[model samples]
Structures are given as structure tokens and as C-alpha cells.
Target: MGLRWAVREPQLGDVRSLVEAELACFEDPWPPPFFISEILAEGRFNRVLVEPAGALVAYLFCAWQFLDLHVLKVAALPVRRRQGLGRTLMELAERHARESGGESLTLEVRPGNLAAIALYEGLGYDRVGRRPRYYANGDDAVIMTKRISG
Candidate 1:
């Protein structure tokens, strides 16, 4: 999955919508247990963006790995694509990473996903490496990283 920025803490009620959004955005979706687990994963910093009516708009599920914040899954709901949500999320993620004493923000995306790649590049994340056959569909993953300034 590639996408999201969060404004709300996910609730048990938000899991199904998050799952649905994940299913909607990704060809190979993660199982519900991951979303379920996040509801109580206090040590983690993942978050969801929800509408005032409680609809899930997007989410950022990331893990702090050593000195870097690694974005595991990020996606906006299909209807909410563009309009700067991805940029907001990435900018916020970078800020959070820096505040948490991180040196970089990192993520992986499909090489064919030019829109997402463009977004990452526009945000200063440079392609640094590649993981061959990274997706279930056998697509190679392009690794991108942005160094955070204090």
C-alpha cells in the first residue's frame, strides 16, 4: 500500500473502515488483524484521518526502526485521492521523525506507481535502493529516503 496522513487516533470502530479503505486502495491488502492490533499498540505512532462524521479518510501506519521512521502502509481512500493529503502526511511524518530524534524517514513504493514516486520525490525522498520481487504480485520495490534536519 502507498499513501496517508492521520488526524485521529484509530478506534475499534475505525478498523473496518480502515480495512475497507486498505482493500480499496491496495491490490494485495493486509489482513484485519493488523488494524485490530493497532487499536492498542501504544508504543507505535500510527494514526488515521477520519471525517467529522467518523468516516476514515486515510491512515499512516509506520514503525520507528532504530533512527528512522519506516512507513509500512499509507493510503488515502480512493475518493480522497490528491488535494495534498499525501503531502500533508509525508510532511507530518518527517516532522514527527525529527521530533522523535530520528535521522530519516523511509518508505517503499512500486516503481510503476509514478504518482506516488513523484509525490515522494517532491517531498525530498530520494530513491536509494531496490528490493526485487517485493510485492506479492512480484513487483520490485523502490526504496526512498529523506534525511531530516534538526
Candidate 2:
């Protein structure tokens, strides 16, 4: 049988695993301190998908700003990609945002990240704008937003 995975709200103890996953997934990943701060910050919703053995395979970080929820970061371990964990994390983030009274959810993705762009688009996100040179490596960012409905 295939391994079963579960998603839950992240705790302080999961910071290390989350950071490790981030490093494995991103070329310019956020440092461990950033994960720590985001997980501990007020108005932030952090979720993690864990394997049966308690290894974190995916994570999503988002923050509620007034009526808007901003997706700060999301990633799945390389071995766990294309298995719907990213979609699951995004769904959880949307639900949390809606429950928090958010009217919309916004995120920025690199123009070169076709997989992420396709995922957001498939989830009903629309491209709203672009930010030039948004990344440290001079990649432009594509800004997308999805409305939250009751």
C-alpha cells in the first residue's frame, strides 16, 4: 500500500524539519530563523504534511493582513512532489483564511515557476499584477489572487 500522509497545524518543534524541507525544495530558501519567526508570528497560519513516521513532507505559510491572506511560502519535499500535497496545503490555507474573515488570498511566484503558476491557476487564482526584479536573482514575480467565498 502507498504511504498515508496527514496535514496539521505546525508547531514550534517542527521548525527544523520545515526548514530542511524548504532547503531541499528551493534554490534560495528562507533561513531557519525565518521559519521560526513565521511559525511563531501572530496572524500567521502554518501547516505541515507529515509522513506516518513523523517526517514533514510539505509545508505552507500564510499570514492574514486585514481582509487579505498572503501566502508567504509553500513547498513539498522533492520526493513528495506531484502527489497532491501542495494542493492540500493550499486548500488548508484557504480554509484558514476564510475562517479568519479574509476576503481574498494573494501570492507571488517566480515567472519561471511554471508548476507553481499552474497549481495556482488550477485553484482559481488570477494574475493581478507583476513586480519587476522581485527575487534576489533578478527574476520578476507574477502576483496572483483568489477570492474567498462563503
Candidate lDDT values, in order: 0.81, 0.88
Q: What is the lDDT of residue 65 in candidate 2?
A: 78
lDDT of 2 at 35: 81
In model 2, residue pairs whose N, Cα or C atoms come closer than 3 Å (at least 3 residues apart or on different chains), thus clashing, are none
lDDT of 2 by residue, 17-126 (tens): 87777788998988988887887899888888888989999989998878899999989899988999889899888888877778999999998899999999999999
| TM-score, one value per model | 0.90, 0.93
- Measured by TM-score, the strongest candidate is 2
Candidate 2 lDDT score relative to the true structure: 0.88
Please list the Cα RMSD from the true structure of every candidate, rounded to 1 decimal place. Answer: 3.8, 2.0
Candidate 1: lDDT of 80? 89
Per-residue alpha-carbon lDDT of model 1 for 1-150, expressed as tens digits? Answer: 234333866777877888888889999898899888866775566777766676778888878888889988878887888867777667778888888889988899999998889989999899999999999999999999998864
**TM-score quality measure for candidate 2:** 0.93
Model 1: colliding residue pairs: 3-74, 3-75
